[model samples]
Target: MNCKFLAIAVAVILFCRPGHAQTGATVLDDFKPSSLNQPGQEYPQVNSQGYVRFRIEAPKAQSVVVSLGLGGTRGGTPLTKGTDSIWTGTTAGPMEEGFHYYHVTIDGGVFNDPGALNFYG
Candidate 1:
């Protein structure tokens, strides 16, 4: 029993050590508009690393959030409003490759992204 307890304690310590988490690789700046975007839209871009970036123009909105992150387990990716009155944000991490359904929340009301082509289901 003592041996088992000692092993468990060591494992916990190793896992909790600082800098033992994800790598510190920087997110590249190379991003392009998603192919699913509307014909002249420029936002909702995807980077090579599979990170998704969103930009929404809602000058009067109090808050804006994107419903695309961690498979929707987390509420969503909250955007920060810039001085230009445009809200923007990036996913916390790289997302799995493939099509993903997402929507925007402006001032608490959910709405589809005007820049992105609508996809049912």
Candidate 2:
């Protein structure tokens, strides 16, 4: 009886271990407007984990994508068009802390985010 109890305890400990018990990734809902955003703009937000989210309004646009993702090598983060004609998307993974430059591509036309402040170097 003692051996059976010990085996059960060991199994429970292993099953309850951190990282092993989680069934899926957790993305925090707490996000705020980016510091670089233009006044009154709510999009181009960043989360605590460095995940950036964008919301653009282009009612007739065919496709919208942000030029920021996976160290800027994996094309970019593609935004999905919602029923309201808004394009929104979040980065696949957390980005490195600090400033990063990006642009928006709408229907094959590249353009800067109108909501964000422009940065020139």
Candidates' TM-scores?
Answer: 0.77, 0.76
Worst 10 residues of 2 by lDDT: 16-25
Q: Give the deviation of candidate 2 from the true structure as CA RMSD.
A: 12.0
Q: Name the regions of candidate 1 deviating beyond 4 angstroms.
A: 1-24, 71-74
Q: What residue pairs are clashing in model 2? A: none
Determine the C-alpha RMSD for candidate 1 after optimal superposition of all C-alphas.
Answer: 7.5
lDDT of each: 0.86, 0.86
Listed per model in order, the count of residue pairs whose N, CA or C atoms clash below 3 Å is 0, 0
Residues 20-59, model 2: lDDT tens digits: 3222557688999999899999989999877889999999
When superposed on Cα atoms, how far off is each prediction in RMSD?
7.5, 12.0
Off by over 4 Å in 2: 1-24, 71-74
